[model samples]
Target: MLSALLHVTLPLALCVLLTRCRLFDAVAVDLSYDHYAEQRVEHLPAFLAMPCNCLVNLLYIITGVYWLLRGTDNAEPEQGRYLRQVFAFMSIFYAPVQWTRLAVLQRAPAVLDQWVTLPIFAWVLVWIGFIERGAAGWRVWHAAVLELLSVLSYGLALLHERGFEVALGCHVLLAVYKGVRVQLTHGDARTLRNFMFAVLSCCGFVVLKLLDLPLARYRIFQRFTGHFWSKVCDVTQIHFSICFLTNMTSRTKKTR
Candidate 1:
């Protein structure tokens, strides 16, 4: 548990510290209020500037906590717990970072927001690794090495204006590929349904965020906003991921 907490937080702390040092000053991020479709309520405090945006993040905390408690109770192998909980912890840790980004609209939080996303998606890959290779065949160092590469992938952001986007694209692609591959290897009809839902949610998560502004032309999006729905998609993906991974990580359960 302590190791999982460290794995989730240490990177955050390092990113925050580096951001404080202006390491991502050159990074391209929308640091403007106009970046989001949700209008800031002038009467509210900065933290509540965009009520929907700030409040939407609560779903992450809720999803993360809910899934963290779902360990393999009497399962034969127990190693999947670390990967599952690490990913859960990452989700819980993510809420505040994203909320801070919308609230303060500062560089550190903005950079941290984008930086943390790399590992969050990477953890999915890690979880899939455990699903493919059971406990005994997987080692702690294997997770460490992959996650270390994920953490380092954030360096791509400093290279070009669109570097972060490029890195994020790769992470999303690899996760999707691994997910599809695992379905063929270990998934049955039930897992396939869960995987499809997860992929749809993942697509919504990306597309809605990208269309945040354009979607504002619609009345439904003016208040709720595309960003808000994107978060809904985010939490939805997490939920399905938990369901899918929980099943796959179970050693006693038979897969087709």
Candidate 2:
């Protein structure tokens, strides 16, 4: 019953809220105009970059919920330990980022902020943990490669107007890595579903933007699609994580 409620009813409720509310509509208009005006006057692309951050934040919230609920046990011992360590690191890192964004950027960071910092942190930490645990051979060369790419990406974001693209590219790679890792490690149906939803949600936003759909005018569709996709990503992640953890716990008990 709990599972059914989480799987079915929760999604339905999210769909209704996203489609019916006027909140995101107002925010979109405010942010779009703010960005356009800033670009026109200050020649600053930072304002334009804000919306993408918001989108990423939304994705993070969805994914984070999954991590919290998924219970960690379904993953292989190495993967599970890595995930926990990474998540703990991220939760710590998030405090500073959130503070800086609020104090300096003067904008409230979105829930998806975790996506920007958390996942990468998780990956790096996981790799480190893997080496520490002696579960996998550590390759300094591989670490160097990843670190170099990460630095290049960060530098690009700081140096040019195209920095947003560089950042987005890095995010795309991160998402791909997570998807591949999850699949290779677990091969769970729920994990696949989560990946699909994440990809679809990101793609859907890009499509909407490209189509130039007047979301400001079409309040209903705007709210519904916005909220629905957001929640879909959220629910999918939670479902996958919980299922993964449950599987891991069961496996461990059996082994013991």
Candidate 3:
């Protein structure tokens, strides 16, 4: 019953907020559209693009919160400690990366080519933290596989022009594997919640990519739908993260 409610209500609520708030308008402008000669702003219709990007950014923030919470909860104390350390390290490393984004937001090629690697690098550190904290057995193996895949995806992105395609595929696989692993290992309501959250997160990204497709002739509807869907994704991430943190902090008392 709880699952059903979350599944139905959460997405609906996000959609409502996104459409009503004009989020898409804000983001499209912020993302910088002056780079591509062919990607002229005339086609975007500022009214639509602004809200679309806004909603997408909102989703990103929400997902960050969700993962932090969820990951913390499900994490063992030892694991939690290491995660914090890794997060701190990544945060420091990423500071410069973000500065680079601000400094070169106008430089599209640099942003996509160089700046985007920061998060990938951070995740590598996270995987190492997991290993150090005793995320052994199959979990360790799984993390190693993901790390390798992530590195390869980045490399492919750098080497080939079709990096986004490869990266997206890898993201999907990673999401699926993590979701299944959590559900199988935990076998609790929280695990189910995490799975749902993971699905929503992936869907959010997928929808964003779809919105960018050239098929849309009218910008208004496209922007509206894109923004709305993006928010739904963001909320799911936050919910999942919180659930993760809760699970980690409060374990079932051991039986005598």
Candidate 4:
């Protein structure tokens, strides 16, 4: 338990400290925007942006724990109960995967480790599809299809040299499609906007990931820029989507 706490809590603490200290403020201004975003440092804040991101992985843990208990506490209808339970199972996996990811990033960050993160993202994609759309017949199939395609993409990536890139592209396209579908189908304006933001964040995650390796060679980007931005994009894409789901679900119950 102590070992687990250090793994999970320490990076979060450093992130909070960096945020509170405004250690990145001066650097942010120095690399200020020029409309075109030439310097990579302009994107640094996304990586280090406090509170939201600092607690993202932690949020996954909390969400996981909550889901573990949700089955007993929340008495929502049985219609989506199975789906919710599956989501809980995924959440249980997600928290540890996130911790393992941090450990890998700290010690021996590799493409393989990065690839491991994809399953969690894939699960989120499927969950959002199910929850936002209501688990009608077509919706259930949609989520399953998305999961199958995601797995196939990863499988392809593992089999070939540039397979990872191909897999990443496929997943990004699929995630965007799902987000856009929600945006179009949902009547609520806030829900629509949240889905739109989720799509953009998903794209941002892809871009940051693709650039991580290339930017690592540069002096300035090497100074924690790659890892920082990667975490930022990861948090933005994943956590915000979860918040949107939770928010919409609660509002949905309130209305009904």
lDDT of each: 0.85, 0.41, 0.42, 0.50
Indicate the TM-score of model 3.
0.51
List the candidates' TM-scores in order: 0.95, 0.46, 0.51, 0.54
CA-only RMSD, every prediction: 1.7, 13.0, 12.6, 12.2
Off by over 4 Å in 1: 251-256
Comparing 2 and 3 on TM-score, the stronger one: 3
Residue pairs in clash, model 1: none
Worst ten-residue run, lDDT, model 2? 29-38
Query: What is the clash count of model 4?
Result: 1
**Ranking according to TM-score, highest score first:** 1, 4, 3, 2
Query: Model 2: how large is the Cα RMSD against the reference?
Result: 13.0
**lDDT at 164 for candidate 3?**
48
Once superposed on the true structure, which residue ranges of model 4 sit more than 4 Å away at CA?
Answer: 1-116, 128-149, 213-222, 247-256
- lDDT tens digits by residue: candidate 2, 165-235: 55655655665565566456544566466555546655654454433334424556433434334434433
Mark the regions of model 2 whose C-alpha exceeds 4 Å error after superposition: 1-33, 36-79, 88-134, 138-152, 177-190, 205-213, 221-256
Model number with the top TM-score: 1
Estimate the TM-score for candidate 2. Answer: 0.46
**Best of the two (1, 4) by lDDT:** 1
Residue 210, model 2: Cα distance from true site in angstroms: 7.1
* Per-residue error (Å), model 3, residue 88: 9.3
- Residue 127 in model 4: shift from native, Å? 3.3
